[model samples]
Target: MLTVQEIRELIKVVDESAIDEFTYETSGETVTMKKSGSKAVAAVPDNGAHTDHPVDPVKNSQPNIQVEQTEVSSSDEKPIVETTADFDHEIVSPMVGTFYASPNPESDSYVTVGSKVEKDTVVCIVEAMKLFNEIEAETTGEITEILVEDGELVEYGQPLFRVKKK
Candidate 1:
């Protein structure tokens, strides 16, 4: 999984790189963006099979983009996760913007290497369009890792924090 900031940076990279279309695929996820008209396209495995879908305009900086998806049946119950065994939950970004784990540049971060959090806990702030949006932990767990640094640009649905269920 990638942090929202990482995704934003990727978009920036794509735009700056002067590429028309970018496609990336991992285990069960596929992301593609075209710089011609407006939005990017995505192919993701919804139930179990690969599906073609358009990226949401509200989530991406570009609007009026649409993709389609095809749902398939999945036989497996749990996916084989690869990482340190301490974490079980992932905290994801709800919008495309910048990520800051603290209030400001001069303030200490909300959590560090092993911070514990709960649902509704203010974990950090994501700035979008000059507006500071408070990002809260939607799951209760111990902080296993922080995916991005402060002041980094992020994208919608990106992973920001990995948590270990307490």
Candidate 2:
């Protein structure tokens, strides 16, 4: 069995390199890693097979791997354009995790619509891997809208709050 640190290191290597997919199999365990945009997903599937000892090299052969590339048409792609014209600045999430509006469930929210904030003001918290990371507003402005709700899952670069410049 692979350790958590080993799996994390493998993910980091795959993310930094140009490789889109990676697969490894040993005994009864198989691990697959794939990159989609800026995010990476790792999956381990169960084939209902288990082996205590390693298979003989001469008896067992490695499976052939094939890589396929797909092209997207111009019509199939849709560009993302912000429709709100009132907000001049947006507070975006720095990592993929669960967004929290306040430090605790019973506490009041950090900011709301019409709340003025400075560059270093913490707007929310993103919890990832048992770590609570406070997300700060990198711009000085008044929050015009809250883009994400409390306890919502957010992706990296996802807009969390819309702010109107002072």
Which candidate has the top score in TM-score? 2
Instruction: Put down candidate 2 lDDT per residue, 1-166, tens digits, no spaces.
Output: 6543465566677777898889877876666767767655555432222122211111111122111111211112222246655888888765545678887777789998989999888888865434567777879999998877787665445678999988
Off by over 4 Å in 1: 1-85
Candidate with best lDDT: 2
lDDT, model 2: 0.61
As for candidate 2, its clashing pairs are: none
RMSD after CA superposition, every candidate? 14.7, 13.8
Per-residue lDDT value at 4 in model 2:
34
Candidate 2: stretches off by over 4 Å: 1-12, 22-33, 37-82
Q: Model 2 reaches what TM-score against the true structure?
A: 0.61
Q: Model 1 clash tally?
A: 9
